[model samples]
Structure formats: structure tokens, C-alpha cells
Target: MNRAFNRKRDKTWMHTPEALAKHYIPYNAKFLGNTEVEAPKGTEVVEDAVRKLKFQRHIKKSEGQKVPKVELQISIYGVKILDPKTKDVHHNCQLHRISFCADDKTDKRIFTFICKDSESNKHLCYVFDSEKCAEEITLTIGQAFDLAYKKFLESGGKDVETRKQIGTLQRRIQELETENSELKKQLQDFEEQLMMVHGSPAGSISIQTQSTDVFDMVPFSPVTPLVPTQANNASPPPPPTTLPPDISKDLFGAEPFDPFTCASADFPPDIQSKLDEMQEGFKMGLTLEGTIFSLDPLDERC
Candidate 1:
């Protein structure tokens, strides 16, 4: 019956629900101290509050039980970890004074941090089981101090003046950008005008594209026929043509009027006949070539 009762009691486990609960918020190490005492040196790394190599001392004491308590606290910057090394509660630690010591390779898993104590101003050393964790924590602390110092100024605050100068430069750059945009627009308008004036006559305006290849185009202009010009050293103009005997006034009638006003018996009748025939033919040719006939009046089909 006792064995059955013991089995039943063991089956009914306590704090099962508590063990399964999830802790989203981070917690600190349970304790940090020498491992000689039968107590926890620090909280488990899984419960670390900061995502860095950190530890916190936790003393587990029950009600009506007396146990010496260990005190631990972090300063404002959160880098200074306050853990007293001596009995007088002195020699606190700051992250800035800490460095990863390059000791001889004794153990690959273990590393040390040499830090200066705040109270005694003497260097204190601490060893860790994880070399990677030590290096990471040391690098983080060094970067933190660097960032803090870079942010610090004469006024014990942020460097606002440098920020203001940067803002001014940014505004100047924006103004320059606006000006550049305006310039580009003007250039585009000029290109369009050029296309209208010069490109249309040559051919369709082949606008240049954003490419490294080059295309050459000829400009166009209207051409006028050349006029003949007389050179300066040309010969003088020919004399005006002599006036022929006035025929329109009919000074000489159909009867020949000789300047001698006398008829010559020596003139041959055949020559006179030939001259009359030639005159008649010349007059007929003039009439045929110079005169226009109205063909419509003579057209019987009309």
C-alpha cells in the first residue's frame, strides 16, 4: 500500500505549469563570485538581461533563514557594473577600464578581462569560461565608450553644431539640385528650338539619345541662284549701232529718189527686176512670220 501511495504521489508532480511558462523579458545571472563556496556564481546565460556577457548575484534564502546577501547594481550608462571585491565594499568596476588580456594560450575556452578598480584605482582581473563571450563583451564595451566620447562635446552634450553644419550643407545641395533641374529644362527647350529651326529642313529631327554612340547630322540652309557679275577689268562696251536710213517716215517713196536726183541709163533692167522680186519676197516673209491669223474665223467646222 505504501509503494502504491509513493508511486501515486510521484505521478502528481508540482510546479509543472510554472516550469513550462515562457519568460519573454530578460533576467540577470543568479550570482557572481568565486566558485569555492557551494553557491551559484551567476545566473544562467540564457537569462541574461542585456544581450552581452553580463552577470548578477542572486542569494537564495528561505523564510526564517539567515544568509549573507551579495549586492550588485549597474550605473546609468549601463556599462559600469558595481560588484565589490573586498570586505569593505570597495573596488567597483567600470566597463571602460576593462580590456581582454592576451595571456598565453592555456585554455581555449577560458579568457580574462583586466579592469581597474574604482575605489583603489588598481587593476583587477576576472576570468571567463567563454573566450568568445569575453571578446564580444570587451568589443561592445570599447565601441560603447567610443560612441559616447564621439557624442560628447564641450557642453557635456551632443555635438549640435556639427549637425547644424551638415544640415546647412544638405540644404545647399538641394538648392543646387533645383538649379540643376532648371538648367536641364532650359537646355531641353533649346534643343527643341534647334530641332524646329535647323533639323526639319534637313530631315526629321533625330534627337540624340543617352548612349555612347555618336550620330552626326548636317545643318540645312536655303540656297539662292547665283547672279552673273561683270569683272572690273572687262573691255569697254561696244559703240551704239548706227541708225539706218529712216524708212518709217518714207523719205524715199516707192519711186527711187537718188541723192543725185537724176536717172542713170547705165542701170540694167534685169537687175532692177531682180531687186523688185527680192523686196516682194522679203515683205511676204515678214507678213507670214510677224502676223497672227484668227483660225477660228476660218474654221468651217465651228
Candidate 2:
């Protein structure tokens, strides 16, 4: 017994779950815990990258003193005053854009609080990494406009119904303008006809009344009764006449018929026969017995 039973060999076990959670795992662990390590501290330098985006410019600052930098610009109106191509010199559209100070401190740089176009007049904020891109990130004005607009529309312009309504209104406006132009052309033609009928230049007419139709000059007249003693009256009057069919039928119905309709008589006979053959083939296949039969296809079946 050299150690006299070694003092009964003291043994101790410690269960420190919280300490493990706070120290062992990085979930709540600090690298230097209240002690500054001898490492380079990150310096957050704001790098300025100027982007000449499409549409218009929106200064982030207010009109008064010390205007804040505008984070984004919305291209509510895009007027193409000049273009490389001469054909489309002046075309306008609705576009938008967003600009912000970038932080390229690391290879995996990130954009912080990216202010983008919002609804009618709002701004959106979010964070996105410049890395992890499946596609190349080439900066273009159009692309920037689209990005901001898309994000803004997703946020502020979330009302799909409203967008649909706006689209409908725009279409209606275009239709009205087209109709107005047609009407103006028709008016000019009528005026020319009037000038020819009057045997004078159209300019001779007063400017105020030039728009009026020449037919308007013909006033309504009452039927005058003829005396029975007239020599022509000796012949018996013709039988009562029937009304003519609507003369104005489809006077302006030049609009093309739906191309999808194959049932109309105007359809091509060859195409109609092919279609009938297809239908017959389909019908025969549906039946239990696969029997093929042919029917006399009408000339107007198409």
C-alpha cells in the first residue's frame, strides 16, 4: 500500500450544457469574447458607381437645402428623342431605375438597403449579393430600369387588377385615336366630293361651314299630289311595292372573321375535306370495332 489506497482516488464529472451551447458551438460563441484580437478591422468604405440608367433621373434629396441623394429614378415617361435608327426617332414608353452606394469590400460583396422604385411614388428597400449569379451581371440602363420597375411593381404596384384596368384604358385610348383619324380622313373625302359637286374649290367655302356635309343642303320634300286629268295618269298605277332589304347591312363590317372558325361555308373545301377525314378517323377509333367509313363531304363543309 504505497499510496495508502491513493486517498480513495477522487473523481469528478461536470455537466455544463449551457456553457457548451455558449462556448463549444458557434451559435452564440464569439471569436475573441470582449477582447480585441490583433486582426485587421473591416473598414466599410462606400464605393460610388455611377450608372446612366434609362428613363429619367430622380434625385434622392429634397428640393430644399441639403437635398438627400436620390436612391432611385422611375421612368414613368420614356421619350426617345433620338435613336441610332432614323425610323423610330421619337417613341415614348414607361420605364424606371434605381441607384445606390455599393460596398465592394470583399469578393462576395453585398448591396445593403437597396432603394428601388416603389409604387406610384414610393421607394423599396432590400439587400442582395452581387455574387452567386447564374447569369453575368452586366450593368445597362435598360436592365437597371427593368430591375427597379419589377421590384417596385412587385411591392407597390401589386394590384394586378389595377394594372389590367390601366392596360384596358390605354388600349381604349389607342382605338379612339385611330377611329378619330379615320373619321377625319372620311370628312376630308366628303369635303372634296362636295367641292366637285359645287363646281368650286373647297377653299371657296367659309371655314366655319367647311366641315358640314354637302348632302345636308338637300332638304326634305313633301310628295305633291298629281291631277287625275293628266295624260300619264290614264295608265293604271303599279302595284304596291315591297320594302327593299336593309341597304346598310354590314356597311362597315369589313373586319376579318375569326381564323379559327372552320365550320363556315367560306372555309377552303380541301381543308374542310381533310378536317372531315380527321373527324371520321377519330370517331371510328372511339367505337369498339375499328371500322373505317367515308361520307359524302359537303362542298361547304369547311
Candidate 3:
């Protein structure tokens, strides 16, 4: 368990000084811009976007060379010019052209840095007074500028990606709105068809609708009958009779009937007796005063 705990990785390893150099280079610079002016100087530049070039001229207490000035500002995109005494900034953001060469022109050892002026358009030169380390100072400044410019370009790429996401969302919203309209149209068509059915001849019952009816639907509803439409046009039924021949075919406008068998069509004696007794009660001024009786047609109900 102890070994496993000891093997935990360092999450902050990337923030270490050595690891940080991959994204940024931190270098202290010296100023030797004027070869004729002799002064003891301590110089360093530090910042997030643009590094300030600070110069503290070393001289006797009575000398004018003992001045603290911050005049040049450097970043990845371009350089800025400033007032040395007042420290006021000047010029556009893209203000300077920077390149380097050896002071000896070919020595490659005694390095010199050069930058073009924004207003003058002429080049200014500088070199660290230290004989052995001037080359290191010149090379470090060049690399720092490169990294800053790369970051600026990456920021622009993020803006383009955000615009693309916005455009995609707008198109999706339009599609949803169009689909909602089509659904509303389909619902309207279904309501109209329902209204037509209620007003047809099949639905014979009259329904009174109110002005405040919800969704324009019918106010009253009636149940439909199970009988077919042909029943309405049929003739009235015939009176009950005790004849052998079937007379129903004429009453209902049907074809004349033929006998089912070559014999007399008659009820059983017991059935006929019950039917006659029921009929005699009608003569006694009663609609019916008899026992139960039933009669079925040969093929269908009467």
C-alpha cells in the first residue's frame, strides 16, 4: 500500500520552470543601444503579453547617466515605443521591425540587436557590453517574440469556431418550427371531417350546438341504431291470419313465395289450440288473456 501511494503522479510537473520553457521563455535582457555613451547599467524585462524593457543607468551621484528609464516594449506581435522620462506609450500596436546581426558583421560572437523605429523608419542598434554573453542575450529575445505571436493567432481560431456553432443552432430551430406548423394543419383537417360526419343523413338525430362550444365540436350526441338503412323504405306489416298460404311477400313488395314442401302448411293441433284461445280473449274485450305461444317463419322471423 505504501508503494502504491508513493507512485502517485505529480499533477503540477508541467508548471515547473524547465517544463514551462516549452510555451514561454523567461530571459533577463541588457541594454547597449548607444555604443558612444558609457554608463553602468542593470536591465531586465518582464510581463504577460508585452515585456517592459527596464534600464537603470549606473553612474556617480552627480552624473546625468544615473537615470532610470523604460523606453522599449516587446511582445510577439510587434514592439511599442514609449517616452523615457514620462513613460507615456506611443505608436500603433504593429509598430516595429526587428532583426539581429553581429556587431562585428561576421564575428557571430559579439552580437548586436536591431529594431526599426516607428516614426523615423530608421533602424536602432543595441549590444550587451559583456564580451562573452552578448550572443545569448540576443538569441533569447528573438525566441520570446515568436511565442507571443503564436498565441494571438490561436485566439482568432476560437472566434471562428464559436460562429459555426451559432449557425448550426439557428438551422435546427427553423426545422422544428416548420414541423409544428404541419402538425397543426393535420389537426385542423381531422376536426373538419368530424363535423361533416355529424351533419350527414346517417346521423339522423338533430343536435343543437351552443355559441360557447369548446373547439367548435357538437354539443349533443345521440346513439346510432343497429338496423340497416333499407328498413326505412319497407312497407307496413300485415295483420295476423290463420291461412295456409304465406301473404307476407306482397306486403313487403317481395316476389311471390313457393311452398317449402308439396304439402299443406299448418301448425300442430296443440299450437293451434293455444293461438285460438288467445284470439277469443280479444272478443271478450281484452288485448290478450291466454297462456304463452310463439310462431316462427319458415326461414326468418316475422
Candidate 4:
């Protein structure tokens, strides 16, 4: 494993046990062939040929190969194979990437597990010779897997709760926006009604409208008089016995004159004769004044 990868992994929370065991990878089983070993019946024959070739390659690689020994350190973080004497790390796999772990069916002292390679992202088999502690190592790996899964579920639950809260807030915002729009519409209607009642727009007045400055000032007077005070309370004075002058008699005659009703036949003959004489005198006065003014102008010319 890369030193930088190990440093990054060290930053995470992990539980490390004191137990350590000798570990190695069988040359032949270090990595399984990438191709699928199983196929449908019709394709099985062709797949089988490919599988045999892969097995032969494994056998040839394993011949006379000497496996290097390392120390197996298992933890909640994953599996680490360290150089026993130098303490240098050779391989590291994360807990979540491990797919399988158990004791070999033929050898009880051999602990084996399949984990994905961090660098290549390929599943590789690790074999540990734990002697009498193989079962304990396998149990530790199982417990680590359980812990990792539980953490995953907890994080997922928190995400779901956060999403629900966000949705509720968004709905509340939409409701407020709808209410705000309705309030704006109501205000506009109120302004229009006010305009109709006051005979003006909401914020403006017509220039032709009369001002109420005098009415708004103090010392207002009532049209009717106030009640008399106790000291001044007395019976009103009686009207005078003398009658007012007859305006119609002075303008026309003793009877009230009606231009629409009175005709030439309605007048007595004697009063009609007097009216004709007054009309002739009025015409004679106008003619004498005109002659005097005309004689003066002629005298100036002479």
C-alpha cells in the first residue's frame, strides 16, 4: 500500500487489536481470474475452456514459488499486512471493501479473506496462518463489518431527516409567498374603493377640488344660535304695527301687476288714456334733448 494512503486512513477512527499473526498470499490464489467462471448451459463449454487455461497459468506460477511472510494486523479500519521486523506496511484494505472471510475448509490454521485492492479496485485473497487464533481473527473481522454497516445506516438516517426538514421549510416559504400576494391584491382593491369615495386617487388630489383650510381651523360657528343664558332669557319683543311699503303698488298700481295676465282690455278706459298721455310726454322729452345737442354741433360748424 502507498504511504500516503496509509496516512489518510490513519486520520479516521479505527479500533486496533494487540494480536498479530503470520500472513501470506498463495501465489496461485493471490488474485482470481477476472473472467466469469460460471455461464449458461449453451455458453458453459466455451467458458470451461477459458477456466482451464486460467487454472494452468495459476499452477505454473505457483511452481517452486516461495511465499514471503508478513504480519497480519486486523482492525475496524480493515486488514493490514506489515513487514514483521521492519514494521513497514505491505498491503491495506478498508473494512467496507472486504467481501469475505473464513477459515480454510482443509486447513483450520489458515485464515483467508477477500478484499478489494484500493489501487486497482480488484478483489484479492489474503491468507493468514494464525495457528490457534484463526477463528478469533475471523470473528474480529465479522464484528468490524457489523460496526461499519451500522454506521452507514446511521448516516443514511440523518440524511433522510435533514431532507424532510428542508422540504417543510420550503413549503412554509411557498405559503408565505401566497399569503403575501393575496394581501397585495386586497390593498390594491382598498385603494380603488377609496378613490371612488374621495373622488380622487389614493395618494393624489385633483387641482380643481376646494381646500378645507378654514373648516380645519378652530373657533367654528354654528348656523343656529345657542340657547339663551339664564340672565338674558326673556320674552321676544313684539313686531311693529306699521306695515311695510307696497312695492308692487309703487311700481305699477294698487293691484299687483302680472305681465303674463294683464292685457290692454283689462285696463279701465280712463287709466288707459292717462298711460297714453305719459308715453307721449316721455317721447317729447327724448326729441327735445336730441334737438338741443344737434343744434350745438351745427353752431360749432358755423
Candidate 5:
């Protein structure tokens, strides 16, 4: 039978009448501490009131930070199940996983459990202040144990898969090694063939020669010297002389027209008008300055 409810306030249990009678809520459900029950011995209390407090309650505040909170935690009858190493491993080899919302909108309480042996899997246990989380904790622990057990069964043995992978890798290595050995043998045979074909395997050979005149081999004492042909002798070239070129006429013919004295009428009408106006203004300004200096009454020296 499964336990299900909102562990915060809606504290309901999902179980048959027979299952509810058999399963008992412990008198002391406190984690890392002890508790006592005040109810009658056979009373049907759905839960124990003992709660798990924060680690800060036992810590001392030195300087600005809270120092380590120490506790004398004993697993009662088992080994030191509460490991100080801070790792998530629980009593069983399975991991200890817990989740909780610490906000004011939701009841801030944690629920946690671990997978026990298959014989004890029927009873899912948890520690939580909120009744909603407590019911959720029971169902979650049962599902976790079922899933973990299935995974454990699937990954139990290592012989078949491991051996197959090792055999495949070994075959591939052997194939590469065999191909390398065959190539080395072929290279050795080719080297031997080359040595047999070449005369000197270490170095090449050299052929030397000595020159001699052809007259020594023939009897040519009666032969006279032949007459020289016209092609045998060539005439010398004439000597070089320094001479100046005639300047009677220009080499480029007539000189080019002077661009400075060229007519401004060849330009566009607007450009010509601008140039003519500038020249006329200069002449008028010079005449006005000359007349002003000559006829000024303030110029006594003129």
C-alpha cells in the first residue's frame, strides 16, 4: 500500500483498513535527536510531533559567520550512517536525495529517505515537519527504491558486455599489426631485387678517357697545305667619329603657342566674363588709388 497526502496541512494517508492497522507511526520519529510519546500506548496517532531542527540552532556565532554546529550523532545500532564528509551517500549504497522549498509562501521543511533491502521495501520512512511533504516522502521513497532496484538488476553483471568490447579492440589491433608486418617483408624483398640489378650497390662506377691526334695514326707526310677561301678572312669595321647634328631647322618644326598669352575668348562665356571683369576691376582700383593719393588734401608731401 502507498502513502499519499499534502504533507503541509492536508495530512491524509492512502491505505486499506488492514494496512493502516499493521503500519504504526513510531513514538520517536526524530532525526539526530531523541523524543518521547505522551499519548496512550494503543492510541492510533497518524504522526509523531518530534521535528528536525536546522543545524544553526546548535552553532555559535563568532565574528560575522555561524561556526560549525556539532552534534553527537549515533546511528543507534548501525555504523556511523551520518557521515561527516558532506557527500550525499545514505545508509544504503544508494544516494541520499532531498528537495524542499525554503520560501514563506510554502511550508519550509525537508523530506529525505534511502533505499533499503527488498524484504524491507514495503515500509517507506521519512522525517518531515510538514504533513504534506511527509506523505509525498513516503510515495517518493517507494518509487525511488523500485527504480533503483530495477537499475541495480540491469547493471549487476559485467562479464558479457566488457568481454565483447575487449575482444573487438584486440581484433582490430591484431589486424593492424599483421598489415604492418606484411608491408615490412615486401619492402625487404624490393631492396634485395635492387641490389641484384645494380653493379655496385654502395656507389656508381666512373669511365675515364685520354685524347690523341688523328695524324699519328695515319701516314700524311706527302699531303700539302690547302689554299685559304674568301670565307676564312673578314674585314675590320670603320672607326667611330664625334659629329654634331645640323640646327638649320627645328626638330619638332615650329615652337608651340605660348599658353600664358593665349586669348581668354577661347574659354566659355561665363569663364571669359569672370576673367575680363577681374582685369577691369584691377585697373579701376589702381587708377582710383593713384588719384586718391595725388588729390588728397591731408597729403601735404604730394
Candidate 6:
């Protein structure tokens, strides 16, 4: 029974949640004194003897003051003073608000620092006595401050890099937008030119596709000749007469020939006989076959 109970207890303990680890340093120090001091506004004022005078005056004021035992807690965020017995907070000064911290050269057990009061808006000097651990306390505070500053720089660097990337992306987006606008303008101009050439909008233009086959392109229709009608009774035109060979040179020349008036003695026998037959045919109002017709007017024809 005892062995079973022990096993169960061990299992229960193992299953229980563990606490998260906390990081901080605590030192026992005697609060020597605190005094309000003039805030340094610039490097010149900081380097002047006025700060030294204030420091000396604060030290003098702390000479007879009662020293109270307090706990100085240091962390990456800030420093705090707590009552050792009741665990009550006395003062809390954030790391960023602390302006200065230094150890006394004459006494290794004494250290002093100045911080801005959040509520009073004043600079206050605090002096502490930590016996042999004075240097260790100051060193711990310095280390915490260093770590915090390094962390701040790391975060700030990431933010700066992110901003640079965002800026580059923004600039690239702007360039692409500008290029897009130019392309749109060019497209509009090209469309306008197309409209001017085609006498219509580009979208409204149509393509006339020609048939590939010759037979499909032309319509096949039977042609019909017109029949004669009584209302339009007109005789068909006579066939055109044939012109004699060399007629332009012989009949219409500067010196024309008069066949009938010409003497038979001036022509060959064959030509004289042909001319006699043509003149007789013209006077009888008859057309002779295979005979050249005279160009004279006829009164009637059979």
C-alpha cells in the first residue's frame, strides 16, 4: 500500500505545472539621502561646475540624515526600492528616466544616481550605502541598462529595415502605375488612328470574308432574251457595212476619186467592167452579189 501511494504522489507531482523563471537582482542598501536638483538642459551645463556644486551640496545635506535599510531591486526595465520586511515599494525609477549613476572614489561602499521624478517633474539625486556590495549593485544596474539599450537598438533596426522595404515597394508600385497609364494612353491613340483609317470605331469595324471556292462566290442565273412587243415595235438595226480596202487613202484623200466620172480609158479592163456593173445596179435599185457597192444615194430598193 505504501509503495502504491508513493508512486501516485510522484505521478501527480510530475504532472503539476511549473512556474516561469523570473530575472532580477536584489541588493541590501542603506538609503543615505535624496535631494531635488536642477535638471541639466544641455551638454555645456552638464560639463559646468554647477553640477559639481549640487553634488557636493547633496552630500553635505546627507551628512546627518538617518540611514534606513532598504532593498534595491534592478531589472532590465528599471530600478526599484522596496521595504525589506513588508515588501512595500518606496521608489520606482524607470531605466529611461535615470540620467546618471556613479560610485564614490573615496568610499567603495557608496554610490549615487540622479533620476527624473514622473509626478514632480524634477531631477532628484539619490545616494546609497551598500557596504562591500556597493560596486556590485552599481555594476548590476549598468549591465541591465546595457542589455535594455541593446534590445532597443535591435528593435529600432528592424523597424528601420521594414520601413525601407515598404518605401521601395511603394516606389515600385508608383512606377508600375505610371507605366500602365502611359500604355493606356498609347492604346487609346492607336485606337483613334484605327478609327481615322477605317472611318469607324475600332470595335465597330467588320471584316468581309471572301469565299474560298470560286463557284460559291458567284451566283448562277439563266439569262433570258427580251421578246418583241407591239408597244415598243422598232425594227432591228441594219448590219454595219464593210469599208473598202484603202478607203481612207482613196475616197477621203486631199484628191478624191470620182468612179463614175472617170474615163474607162484611164482604168484597166477588169476595173472598168466592175465600175459599169456597180453603176447599173445602183440605177436599177438592186444589190448585185460579189460586187463592190457605190457610195452614192439610192431612191428605192427592191
* lDDT value, candidate 6, whole model: 0.51
Q: What is the C-alpha lDDT of each candidate?
A: 0.32, 0.27, 0.34, 0.42, 0.29, 0.51
lDDT of the structure predicted as candidate 1: 0.32
Give candidate 1's error at residue 31 in angstroms. 8.4
RMSD (CA, angstroms), candidate 1:
51.3
Candidate 4 is scored at a TM of: 0.34
What 10-residue stretch in candidate 2 is worst by lDDT?
Answer: 25-34
Candidate 4 yields a Cα-based lDDT of 0.42
Segments of candidate 6 deviating more than 4 angstroms: 1-22, 40-65, 155-302
The TM-score obtained by model 2 is: 0.19
Scored by TM-score, the top model is: 6
lDDT of 4 by residue, 1-302 (tens): 42222322353322232221222221112322222223211123323433454465568668954345566666545567776778787777665655545554355655555555656655455555555766556555554544444443454422333444454665675565566556656666765664455343433322232223455422325852232211122333332233333433432334532432432223345654434433322222111101110112232110
Clashing residue pairs for model 5 = 6-132, 7-130, 7-131, 7-132, 7-133, 8-132
Query: Number of clashes in every candidate structure?
Result: 8, 6, 1, 0, 6, 0
What value does the lDDT take at residue 214 in candidate 6? 54
Misplaced by over 4 Å in model 1 are 1-92, 99-106, 153-302
Off by over 4 Å in 2: 1-154, 201-302
RMSD in Å for model 6: 52.7
Model 2 C-alpha lDDT versus the unseen true structure: 0.27
Poorly placed runs, candidate 3 (over 4 Å): 1-30, 34-96, 101-109, 155-302
lDDT of each residue in 6-125, candidate 2, tens digit only: 211221112133322223211110010011112111122111111211001223223333311111211222212222333333222122312222223353333322222223323222
On residues 147-178, what C-alpha lDDT tens digit does candidate 5 reach at each position?
32233234432123333444466567556556
Deviation from native of the Cα of residue 181 in model 5, angstroms: 4.2
Q: Quote each prediction's TM-score.
A: 0.23, 0.19, 0.25, 0.34, 0.21, 0.39
Total backbone clashes of model 5?
6
